[model samples]
Each structure stands twice: as structure tokens, then as C-alpha cells.
Target: MSVEPLQRSAVAKDEQWNLQHIYATAKQWEDDYRRAGSLIDQVAGYKDRIDSASALLAFLEQEEELGFLYEKLFVYASLKLDEDTRVTEHQARVDRARSLGVKISSATSFFRPYLLSLDKQTLDGYIAQEQGLEYFKKELYDQFKYKPHVLSKDKEEVLSQLGEVISAPKTIFGMINNADIQFGEVTNEQGEKVALTRGMYMRILEGRDRERRREAFKAYYKPYVGLKNTIASTLAASVKNNVLFSRMRGYDSPLHRSLFADDVPVSLYDNLLQTTREHIAPLHRYMAYRKQKLNVDELRLYDLSVPLVDDCEVSIPYEQAYETMLAGLAPLGGEYLDILRKAKTAGWIDVREKQGKRSGAYCWGPYGTHPYVLLNYNDTLDSMFTLAHEMGHALHSYLSDANQPRISAQYKIFVAEVASTVNETLLIRHLLKETTDEPFRRYLLNHFIDTIKGTFFSQVMFAEFEKLVHERAMNGEALTADAFSEIYEALFTAYNGELVALDPEVKYGWSRIPHFYNAFYVYKYATGIASAVSIAGRILEGDEETTKAYMTFLKSGGSEPPLELLRGVGVDLLKPEPIRDLLSLFDDLVRQLEEL
Candidate 1:
């Protein structure tokens, strides 16, 4: 049945996340906003005395406290705006919060440059003398590591002042994609006119009706086709921004600059792309099986998302999904489960889709508060897994916040996906063990295969595309809509092989992906799932020591470098073994599905 999306007011209270946990009222939020602004000014007053140990310690403590309050205010306003983008007041609050954040950045711009002015030995002596400075030892050392990239105080201030303007491309892209682009209606299997949307378009693609799927795919890309030139310009500007920052910072490339932040080796990114390309046969085989199972004359891009076994239905309600996630994550022990239970009832999740709500799911929150998850959930096996995946992030945040100080509580994006993917892996493993039905078991196996294809294969494709575009821009090549489509088409052909028929519209698919605006971000998803596969395999096999190591890694948070943290957990991404093992797992699952 085709139905209109519900209004935000119509959603049940429990189904929505409680933002009052952050601030009970808008007036309270306004008060904190004022307080944060005052603190930013006070912190800036110590600019001349930043070299002193006592002054530095007091400034760091004040900045940390201000950061916590500012984050709470910013998250609440931004989240409320996302809940219903049509609200003007919410939009104003979001703007105010963002503007305040830029001001805060400008106010604190002196800290890094001033700290870099001091020699490492002097900074080390300060850390040893001042007990309070001990808390920010890693942070101070990190600034020293970036000494080469740190600009003069005046230049740094200018750059920091441009933060809001520098972020304009992504802001424009979000408005156009989320609020402006209109996908027209499509006739469904029931012969009713269904309004097509980004979310609805995905559901339509997963339908059994072939014509409807094709219709939705074409309809969804129609606006994108019309706005291709504009989107291309926006994306080009975004890429140019990345190149600009890389040059300004004296890095070899934008990729180098991005990886340098997290201490990830460039070789690791290359290894994933190379390793996945070598193992393309399994992906081709899976495509072949999908074509045969669907019995399509030609496997178009729309056909890729549909289920291989049509009768394998697994619909888990939210309550049941929560219970299943708890059981699946039992290997992490009782204390972890207790935290999950509290998060479940503590209004940490907003669990329904409605009109003008932002599409997709994410876990976000400030350092001092419990992590909040935003989900546009519809009951499906995929949604159940999403619950587990996001909870993985939530628990990770919970543990990190509880263990680390405010300064180091937030983990880097490189290792952030590991926790989330680990939960998904355990949930799938538990499902496979408990299911007795042969067809359903095969379906479970297929789900795992699809996850690899989507998370590992697809993200690597995006990573490669991002790398190519940025490199092209860096090398003085012109980037246009046609140029982007051509690059994307070639990569799609290489990855999909000759088995699947390519659609011309799929070439323009690059414009629709929001992640492109955030350069060098998608590759982490690939590395994350690979790490999870190795870690989950060990836990499922009763490796108690590995399990203990994994738990400790979760608690360590941003206290250590991302690669070093992963090494502590026994998953060394620097080696090719994890990627190879993940490919082997995919091959084994495909064979199992074939046998069933």
C-alpha cells in the first residue's frame, strides 16, 4: 500500500528521541549558547600567556568544558532541524549554532600555533611539571606531529575565520539533494500512483515487480540528470577545496592530508583497492547467481538490490530486534549488555520515518551525553541489522565516554566503523546459528554476501572514484558532468564485469552520492568491515584473549592512534591478510548459497 509520510507531531513520543536529555527547553539551550560564547572569549584572553604551564593547563580545562557545552547545544539544534527540515525556527537555531561554532574556532585558533611555537622538549617539560597538563599529553604531542602543517598565527586565524565559508559547498549540496530535488511519482505493483522519494525509491528498487523497479530507478535519477551540470560544479568546487587545503598545508595530496590526520598509511588504502580487484571473481559470481535467480533477460542496475530468494521473509519488529542484538553481542560480557539495556530505554534512539525527516541512519552525540542514534527504520531484516550496527556505535561511544576524559573521548572515523560492523557480523552469525529453515539459512548467507558487496566492494568503488576525481583536479584536468560520468562508467564496467548489462543512467549515479562532498571518507567503511570480519571470526571461535583485546580497544577510544589501536586488537590492516580473509569468507558464503 502506498501511503503519505507522517508529520513529526504525529509520531508517538517513545518512537522519537528525547532531545530534552540534552537541554530541557529551548530557553535552556539559549542560555548555554550564551555561556559558551562568553567562555570562548575568556579562553581567547589567555593567548599571550599560553606558553606558561599553569596558563596552558587552565586554558585547556576551560576549552574542554566549553567544548562539551557547545556540542550539546549544537547537536540539539542540528538534530531538531533534521527531524523536520521544513521548520524555519529549527533552521534558524541550526544556523545560530553553526555560526557560534565558527566563532569558537576563531577564538581558539591561537592555541595550536602557539603550542607549535614551543619546542617539543619544552612542551614535554611542561607536561611533566603541570599535573593538569598530563591529561592533554597526547593532544600536545599530536600538535607537535603537525608542526610541518601548522601555519603562522595570523594565517591560521584567517583560515579559521573562513571555516563557515569553506563549508559552503557541502551545505549547498545537502540543501539541493535533501530539500530541492523532486523525484516524481511512479505506478506501483498495485496499480496505484506512489510518490517517489529518496527513501521510497530504495524500497521500490527492492520490490519484486521488475517494471516498477526500473521505473523507480529512472525516476529517481531524473532530477539528477537535469541538475547534472550544477551538481558537477558543486562537486568540482568541493574537490578543489580539498586540493586547496592540501596545498595550503604542504601535503603531497588531499588523500595524504586526510590519512595523515589519523596516522593511516597510504599503503593500506591502496591495498584494499588492489586486493578487492584481485578478488573480483567472487563478486562476478554473485552477480551471475543474482541474474539467474531473478531470471532477468538483462541484469540492469536496478536488479542488483533485489533478493535472490524471494520467499525468504524475515520481518523483525523493533522489540524483537533489540532482544536479538543483545543475544548476539553476549560475547562482550554482562557489563556491555547492561549499558545496551540502559541506552535502549534512555531515549537514545529516534526510530521512525516521517515527512521531511532526513534519510538514512547515523549515531551522533556530544562527549558528556549518551550517544544518540537517528534511524528512519522500516521493519525488515536489513533494518534489524541496522539496529545492531548503530548500537555498536552507541556502545562504543558509551564506553569511550565513561573511560576517557572529555578531551579524548571521541574516536576517529577510521576506527569508528569497526565497532558498528562488528555488531553486524555478530548479529548475522547468531542468526545463521539459530535458524533451522534451509531456505532462510541460505537467505542469511546471502545477506552476509550482500553486506560484503555493499560495504566492501561498493565503498571501494566510491573510494577509487574519489581518488581519481581529486587526482584529476590536482593534475590540472577539467572536471565536468560528462567527465565524471565517463570515469564512473568505466569503473562500474570494470567492477561489474561483462555479465551484467550496464545502464546509461548508471553513469550519472555519481551525482546522487552525498559522501563525495566529504572526500576520502568512504574508504574507511571498507577497512572497517574487513577488520570486523577478522575480529568477529576470532570471537565466534572462542578466542577469549582476542575477545578481551577487542573490548579493551573499544575503551581506549581516541587515546591512541587509529592504526595502533587496531593493532592492539589483533587486526592489522597494514597487512593484506585481513582483506584476503574477508574475500575468502565471501567466496565461502557464495558457495554455501550455491549448494542450498
Candidate 2:
């Protein structure tokens, strides 16, 4: 069966978000590029001319204004580039942004070193002389706080130059995964052969044919395993880069450096993995129950995605999904729902899979334009949930961009996952309550359980694996492919706890996770989901105060620290309640599945 191209006429030309939205056309972007380059030379005037307090304040304000203008142009170009990465023109625009960013970064690089050079009394006197300087006091302090980590300006510049090449390993991995590697065909039980690729892997993995799923898993990982050494080298280089940078910058460890960038406490990340490890019994018990419920003699990796209860397919069309999403989020009040309805009517979504299109989904936009979401819309229950999830991000960006300054508009990745998972949490609650059929309810309950297991426990396991590998490399231990495999195998065995067979093939799991290159990122997915469960439960329970606080958190953007933002939403993520509540939800879902 061939997948048909999505109808683009159904949506506005601008809704598709071609590069024209960034500028009316490519030529305009080029012209702006030249204008921006000229402005870069002007920024040099502020470099070393801040002797007086008034001069310093004027220079700082002017520098920020220039930065905002440059960012507006850069974001537009970069967002356009992400849409169709292969397009030469869009790539040119993206290259322009990167080049300009580096140039501007170099130009402004003196600000931090210069500030750090000032003595405490001199800095305090300057701060007092110009009260307006207080707005940037925190920003200045952040830069100086890393003085122990900051190298000489010349060395830092050399490191900055090395940054682009340092990304090659991960970029190579992405190219191999997205553009080059292909999965071989696996035959179904019906004697039909289906070609396997990353796109089709999920659908195949979810098939009723256990043998086909097994073959699919093997075929998918075979290439990865063959190239394990190369992958290991790339990963080692990336992790080594992190360790080197952290140690150079005066951090105790790479993990500390990574978390410090996002202003997150390292303990929060450590606790997420530790708590998840402690609760492995629940995950194991759920997996055991799933094996029996599905009546499989052996539960393999492929069996993880299959629905426990059949005959209860929740096939939702794009429109119905939109309505359900609107209704599901009505607790957000009329204004929020109206914005959603407008998104639906205004063609904010590109709602079908098309030829030569990107796999997966995302939300993208520049400042002036509202956010646009792209989805393949396969009509599965998970697809609907994804629609709800991406919309959560789009709406968050919309609200934050609307209310905050450009510098503060973009939230950190630490807090970025919360809005999307909160949307998922609300959508699940709505469906569980809206349905009356017992079997369907049971299936939905099972689905919710899988969400918790996959998001919280599985990601936390990955985080543990990531932490171990980094620690090993930091300790002068080699990160050979076999060593990596052994570490992951240990984690899998420990977390699985005999629920299912840990296939020897599963040892190559480290080759497949891209987040390891990202450094200390996967744990946030677990922590974010836990935090969302708390926030969503409160809103679902008609806690008006919590709802208001959550809305405030969304609008607050990066104005405060990530923890402060989350705390405002009534989720004490520092405490253990959110994690315990998440585990309780998983336990309840398991009990429901048992009854079913």
C-alpha cells in the first residue's frame, strides 16, 4: 500500500511554513543578512568603552537591542531550515544564521571576561551607580560564576572553533540514521513481506505477529550492531568533549556542568534514576501481567508495544482529535480553548504524511508568526496523543512569546517537556472518563500504564546508562563497544528483573540512543513526566488555585529559574511526592489491568 501525499490546498500557503514566512522570499533574507552583517561591525563600539556608569548602561542596552533583532532574523532562518533540511536555499539561510551567531558571539565575548576582570568593590559600585544595570546583574553573575571554568580568551576562542567539528560524531550518527541506513524486510505470519525502515518499524513492532516483530527488531538493530565500533568512537568523542569542557570550566563532574547549564540541581537527576531503580518491582510485575494478559508464551522486546486488550481500537480522525483535544483542555478555560479552535480553523497543522517528508513531528515558528505543528496523523490512539502533545508545546511557545521579552521567551529544555506531558496527562484523563465500554476502558488503562513505564522508568534507565558511561570515560576508562554493551546489558537485566527474556541482541542498545550525546538530558523526560502527573491530577481534581499557578508558570517563560517556575505550579519536584504519585498511578493502572 502506498501512502498518499497530504492535501496542501486544505491549508494556507503560509501555514505550510515555507521560508517565505521568515521573509517574503529568499532574496529578502539575503538582503537582511547583509544588513545584519553591517550591524555586527557596529557592536564593536561597545566592546571596551564602558569606563563610566552611564556609558556602560547605554552600551548594554544597545547591545541587547541588537541581539534581539539578530535573534529574530536567526530564529526565522533556522526554523525554515528544520522544515526541509535538504533544501539548498534553506540550508544557506541556516548557514547564514550559524555564521552570524558565531560572529556576534565573538564580538560580544569580551563582555563576560571583562566583567570577571572587575574587582568585587568595583562591580558593586558600578551596580549601585546605575540601577538599570540590575536587570543584567544576574546574567553577569552567571558568567562570572564560571570564572573557575573559564579559560583564557584565546583558548576559549580556540574551543569555540573546535565546537563545530566536535558535533561531527553526532551529526554523522543522525545522517546515518535518518538519511543512509535502511532496515531489511521482515515476513509476516501471513506470508507477506513488509520492508522495514525507521518509519515503519513502529507500526511493525506493534503488529499482532510475534515472529514478525522479532524479525523486525533483529533487522533494525543488525546494522547498528555491525557498526558498533564506529558508533562507540563517536559516542566516546562526544562524552570526552563534555568531560574535558566540564573539567576545564571548574565543575566537579560532567553531570554537574550539564545540569548547571540548565540551572537544575544534580541531585534531582540522580534521584530520578535512583527512585526509578527502586521501583523496578512494579514495572516487572506489570510486564509479567502483560505477558499473561496477551497470552504470549514468551514476551520479547517487540511485545512491549502491542495493546493488551484487542477489539477496542481508538481510531480518531484529525478533526475529532482536535475537538477532543479542545474539550480535554477546556479546564484551561474559554480563552485557551478558543485559541485551540482558532488553530484548527486557521490550519495550524499539516495533518498527513507526505512523500520525502520528515519522520516524527514537531512545532516550529518565528516570533511574529503563531506556532505551526506537523504530524503524519496515522489515526492511532498514540497519534492522537502526539497531536495533543505537540499542541501543548506550540501553545506554550505561543503564550510565552506573546507575553515575555525575546531574551526570556524561550524556556530551557529542562522545563520544556512539562507542557507537552501535561497535555498528554489531561488527554488520558478525559478519555478514561469519557468511555463507558469496559474493555475499552481496560485498554486505555493499560495504555496509561505503558506511558508511565515507557516515559518514567525506561527513560530513567537510559539516564542511568548515560551517567555510567560518562563517569567511566571521565575516570580514564575506555568506552569500547563491548564495554558500553556490558554496561547497558547490566541496566536492562536489573530493570527487567526477570519479567521477560533479555535477548543477547539487546546488548547493542547503547548504539541507538541519541540522547547520550546530549548529556544529562534523558532524566528530564522522567522528571518532567512525574511533575506533569502531579499538575494534571490537581487540575483534573478541580483545583482552581493549581490551574492558575500552572497558567502563570507557562507565561513566566525563562524569567525565573526552572525549579522556581515548576514550584509556582504546585509541583514540588524537589520532594519525592511527584515520583511517588507517578508510581502510584502506574500501580493503579496495573491493578485495573489485572481486574480486566
Candidate 3:
């Protein structure tokens, strides 16, 4: 069946996210937009006077208010824009929101430097003396922690003014990927010309028909291949920007700067890479098994994603996916499950794909409002898992917002993926236990194996690639399209060995990865699954104390550092044990698959 893309209006109201919850109408959003500008000005007035405890408390409260309002404005415009990228009006709203964000940043640029100028004792006294200042103690301490990197007020203002300019690389990449580039159409096994998209590409790759998979693979990369140089240039600019900013901030490298922000030690990243390399054999074994199971002449790059157990058919609609997710997450207790139910019925999710919508799934919203998830759900088992995954993020946000203050509600990227993957780990465990049929059980087992491969192993590979590219860029190596492809190809070869054939077009795969733009962000996905696997296992074993501790960790949000947060939940990323244990689990799963 050829899939016809729907327009925004064609999507059912229940299927769509209610952005109106943020603002009832466009005029309301506009009103808040203008009001936010005034709030920024109001916040700027207390800049020089924040040295006193009372003034500092007032500043903190006003600042939080301003941030809350700004989030509502920004998320509304962004959610509207993502609903359909082609709409000029929505695009304008996004631009307006972004501009206002820059203005707010520039206006409040003095906060950091001014706060740092005060003595530590004075700041400590303020936190101890003022009731309101207690809420932002962590926020204040983080400023002092980065004191060496804090620039002069004038320089800080200048940097803040350039926020929009610095964001150009990511903006350009989004424009080209979501708006300009096109993948054209491909004929599927149904003998119909179906439109190929980023979302559809994954579905096609999983199809049993090799020819269609091959065709879709080739067509999908066609546009990216043609624009490789342009995309590469944009990516290069992003790296350079990261390097420049890191250098300006007195950091040795971009990796240090990024990790520093989250309070993650460099050793943690190194440990993950080293441990994953040592455990690469199981991944290679899985690849060989995949080839044998498919009975293919050669397992090419495109064949990697095709289903291993072809006879077991599992199709879950959206409503059923919700029910499945709720049941899967019941281990978290009734409170967590109730929140999940509310998220589904409320306007917390935009659940369908339409023309010009952003690809993939994500959870986004400000502190004041509920977290809204954007998913291009395709009704596949994978899509159902995606629903489970994103709901994890939403629930994490929901719980954090309810428990923590506005300043601490937004979790850091380092620990962000844990909640989502924990949901997935539990879901897969539930499915495996619930099913009695042999083939379906095998399918669930294979899914678990594949999840580890994609989430843990593949992410490590990408992290290695990202680390290499950033090092080269920092060392003044020019990053061109060919250079990027060569680096990725070398890493692919080292990781896969002779188990899978590396098609030439697979080298261009680096150009299409959106995470590359975010600079050293992929490694956390590996660490996240590692922690989640351990955490989920404990919950499934009926460890009530562990479950309570995990809930507390989720509610803590950014109140503490990510490392401490994970430690609170009994999964320490600083040591190599979690990674080793996860690898052991992967080995066992691969062995089980072999037996089956």
C-alpha cells in the first residue's frame, strides 16, 4: 500500500497536539511575546543591584518568571513551526520567537559576570539568609563553578548578542534537511510509486523485499549525496563554532566544554569508548548471525535493519500502543501510570505525520506547561516503542516539573535518555514475558538485541566518529565532505570487521545524521541505555526501595549533577561496571538468539 501524506488540517483533532494549551490563539501568543520583551527589560533592571541578598532574591524570582514566560512563547512558536515546516506563517513565528530569545539573552547578559563578581561568602550568605534565594542555590553555585570561563560583562553581552548568528549552522542544516532537500519517490513491492521521506525510509528498510529496501536506500541518500558538500560545509561550520567557543571559554577542547556543562568527567566518556571497543565481538557475532538467518549472499549495509524473524507479524495502532506502554510501565507504580494516561488523553502529544513535518520523535515544552511529544508515528512495532520512549521523556519532565522548581525542572542531556530507555527496557521485558508463541518470543528477543545494537553499540561508534572529527577540527584539520566520509568509513570498518559488507554509499551516511551537529551528544545514548538496563532490571525484580530511589532521581531533575543523579539511583557511570554489565547482557541475548 502506497502511503499518502496528510495535510495538517486532515489530521484528527485528537491526533494533534493542543498547542492552544500554551496559548489559546495566535493573538494570545503575540500578546505574550510582547509581554516577554517587557519582562526581559524588567529583569535587566536588577543586574547591577544583585550584590545584596534581598536584591539577589528578587532578581532570582523575576528571572525565573521571565524564563517561564519565554519558554511558553518559544515552545508555542516552535511546536507550530514543526507541525508543518512549509508554512510561511509558522516559520515567521519561529523566527520571531528566536529573535525574542536572542534579545532576552542579550538583555540579561550581565547576570553571570555580575554574580561571579560577588565574593563566594557573600553569595553563600545570600543563599543562607534569603528564603527565595534557596531555590536557585544550585544555579548560583554553577555560575561560581564556571568562574574561570566567565568573561567580562562587555564580552558576555557581545557573545549573547551573537547567539542567533552562532546558531546559523544548525538553522541552515534544519532548513536544508526539512525544507529544501527532497528524496523523490520510489516504487515499493506493491507496484505503486510511493513518496519517500526520512520517516518512510526506515519503514522501507524493514520491509522483507530486498529490492524495495535497496531502492529506498538508494533513493533516500540521493539528495543527501548530491548535497553532501553543502551539508558537510554546514557541519564543518558547526564544529568550528564549537571549537571557537570552547577556546574562548578557556577550555582545552569542545568535548571538555560540553562535558563540563553537565559535570560529567572526561574519564566517563573514555571509559565508555574503551569498554565498548573491548566488547565489539558480540556485535560482530550478531551481524554474522543476522546474515545466516537471512540466508543472504551478502549482508550489505542496507540489509542490517531488515527484520530477522519475518514470519511474526506485529502491528499496533496508536491507541493500542498507548495501552501497551501503560501496561509496560506499570512497574513504576500507579502514580507514574496515571501521569502516562493523562499525557495520552490531554493535549500532550502530536501523534501523526504530515507533509513537511519534522522527522523522528522528541519531547519538548517549557517548565510551566506539560511536556509535549512530537512523533511521526508510522504504526510499526518500532513506532510503538518510540511512543513508549518519548512518553518516558514526557513523564520525566512531568514529574520533574511537579517536584522541582522552574530552575531545576529542565533535565540535562546527559541523563535525559534514561527515562525513555527505561520505559523501553520494561516494555520489551513485558512483551517477552506476555507472549508464549515461539516465533513471537524470538522476535521480542531479536528486538532487544537490535535495541542494544542501535542504542548502545551504534551510538558508541557515532561517539567515536564525533570525537575524531572534533579532535581533527581542533587540531586545525580541514573538515570536507570526503574527509568526514573517510573518517566515518574507517570507523565503520573497524566496528563491523568482515561480518557485513560496507557499501560505498554508506559512507555518505554521516551527512544525514542530525546528532553530529550537536557535538559529542551521541555518547550519552550509550550511557543512558546502560544505566536504564540496570535500573529497569532492579524494578522488574520488585525492588521497592530501588523503584522509589529511581523516582526520586527523575524528580530531582537538574537539582544535582547528572553523575550524582545516576549514583542516587544506584547506577554509577564513573566506574566501568555498568558498561561491562550491559555488555554481558548483550552477550547473553546474542547467545539466546543463536539457541533459538
Per-residue lDDT, model 3, residue 73, is 85
What TM-score goes with each of the models? 0.86, 0.88, 0.84
RMSD of 3: 4.3
| lDDT of model number 1 | 0.88
By TM-score, the best candidate is 2
lDDT of each: 0.88, 0.80, 0.87
Candidate 3, residue 512: Cα displacement in angstroms equals 3.6
- What is the lDDT for 158 in model 1? 91
Q: Give the clashing residue pairs of candidate 2, or none.
A: 149-249
Better of 1 and 3 by lDDT: 1
For residue 484, model 2's alpha carbon misses the true position, in angstroms, by 2.4
Candidate 2 positional error at 155, Å? 4.0
Give the C-alpha miss distance for residue 213 in model 1, angstroms: 2.5
Poorly placed runs, candidate 3 (over 4 Å): 1-37, 47-51, 73-102, 119-122, 125-131, 152-203, 211-241, 315-320, 341-369, 372-380, 473-486
Supply candidate 3's per-residue lDDT for 564: 91
How far does residue 84 in candidate 1 sit from its true spot (Å)? 9.3
